[model samples]
Target: MTSQIHVALRPLWLCRACAAPWPCATARLNLLAEYRNSHVALSIYLAGMLYTAVEDLYRLNPQDAPKPTALHDRFLGWTAPRAPRPQPSD
Candidate 1:
């Protein structure tokens, strides 16, 4: 288990812990490690957050349209593919 915790900052949706983007490098790494076998759950969780972030940020920056691809890449993308699950011993 990791000793550190990464929290998100509002409006900008940056990392409160590292002050980088929310789910910043450290947060993303930790999330990947923590949810190694639960990729789908992680994706769902991130997607939910991404939606909320979009809504909040959109209200703040109405003039600049947010790109779905870019937002996905930033908030929930960049994760490495999961490793194969361990097989049970006979």
Candidate 2:
């Protein structure tokens, strides 16, 4: 079977393969694996994409621009390394 390459469709910010939002689940996993060694670099890349998404989405609907917090969570939040939960004291 042929593998689908999950990529951004641009302007629309949807996944080229799954038709989901850009940086869809598969794309996220691929990116995490691809940049496993350089998280800062990944953040920088995602930030740039966020900027472009904001511009494109806003232009598409200026009357209801995408929320900054939601976009931040979508583009960069998931990439953040979460801290382990603290264990209960003995």
- Evaluate model 1: give its TM-score: 0.76
Tell me the tens digit of each residue's lDDT in model 2 across 1-90. 999999999888999999988889999999999999999999999999999999999999989877999899889999987899999999
> What 10-residue stretch in candidate 2 is worst by lDDT?
59-68
lDDT leader: 2
lDDT of 1: 0.82
Top candidate by TM-score? 2
lDDT of 1 by residue, 2-58 (tens): 565687888888887778878888888888888899988888888888999899888
Question: Candidate 1 regions off by >4 Å?
Answer: 1-4, 80-90
Compared with the true structure, the alpha-carbon lDDT of candidate 2 equals 0.94
